[model samples]
Target: MREDLTEQLSPAQIIERAEMSKAFRDVFALAGGKRVLFWMLEQCAIYTDAYTGENNSTNYALGLQSAGRKLIAKLDEIDPQFYPELLLAMKEIREADKAAAKSLAEKLEPEDDADIA
Candidate 1:
């Protein structure tokens, strides 16, 4: 099954694929997809840290929050009516993640010496 999926395409098929890819890129360029991709990458970093028990997820989330604010500022400069709601949504998400991180940190903290003794 894996071999079937890994099979190489013919030259014509490859050309068709390349053309389709170019078309997709053109559409994404017109739709501000780079901003969306950056947002997704930041989100992935934050969640990856959380799931892997890394200590830096909070920092990553904070960086994302900063980026979101910058993006909103840029949007405001370009057009005030363009997706202001998305900025608010991203802010809410960052706040929720911060709360969750705080809760997790509390749970993972070492016990006091008195309790251990």
Candidate 2:
């Protein structure tokens, strides 16, 4: 076990820990269909609730809670900045979406001028 979490660990630690998780076994049993998506969403909701204020329960979701912790635990071995790549892409896409929505909203003038006055 890596004693110092602040210190960057090697991939070996991640592989070792992942091998010990129920989620990994479930991953291997995957038929690569809808269950994978459902399992991921189930686990994600547990993990997400750990941070998000709404629906603030974690463990009530069953295998998902520990499954999420095990997954986050592996991330300690990876480079500190690696996870943000996906977040950056998501942010960029959201900004573009908002801009497009604003343009569309501006184009939709009021149907009745009398309602405005």
Candidate 3:
């Protein structure tokens, strides 16, 4: 129940995040993957928000959007129809994550709570 939104991540959390980022970069390194990344960046840009201190959404979104545009422009790419596929994949992942979180939360809840009520 940490109230601070800007609390620093644990080392393990940081490593997990870094690994995820590296995985994305590895995917982007593949042929035609830049287009997929550019599309993802464009979608993500709008969701950025104030993070305080070192991180600013305005700057991050601006940079992300700019990089996305540059990536797409670099190849003069054709329409890859990435949106539909990515959207579906994201939806599935989100649902799985939600279920996992719910299961974890239930496990962490006090065992005596129901008896108390």
Candidate lDDT scores, in order, read 0.57, 0.51, 0.57
TM-score of 2: 0.36
lDDT of 1 by residue, 14-88 (tens): 687567556545533443454463475466453243333555866666676666566555544434644454445
lDDT over C-alpha atoms for residue 90 of model 1: 57
lDDT string, candidate 2, 11-82, tens digits: 887666556554544543444422443355455664354543335343345446676545444433443432
- Candidate 3 per-residue lDDT over residues 1-108, each given as its tens digit: 333422577778768756765665566455346446645655756345424356575677677667656544432322244334444555666678799999999999
Task: Please give the clash total of every predicted structure, in order.
Answer: 0, 0, 0
In lDDT terms, how accurate is model 3? 0.57
How far does residue 34 in candidate 1 sit from its true spot (Å)?
14
Pairs that collide in candidate 3 are none
Better of 2 and 3 by lDDT: 3
Candidate 3: worst 10 consecutive residues by lDDT? 74-83
Better of 2 and 3 by TM-score: 3
| Clash count, candidate 1 | 0
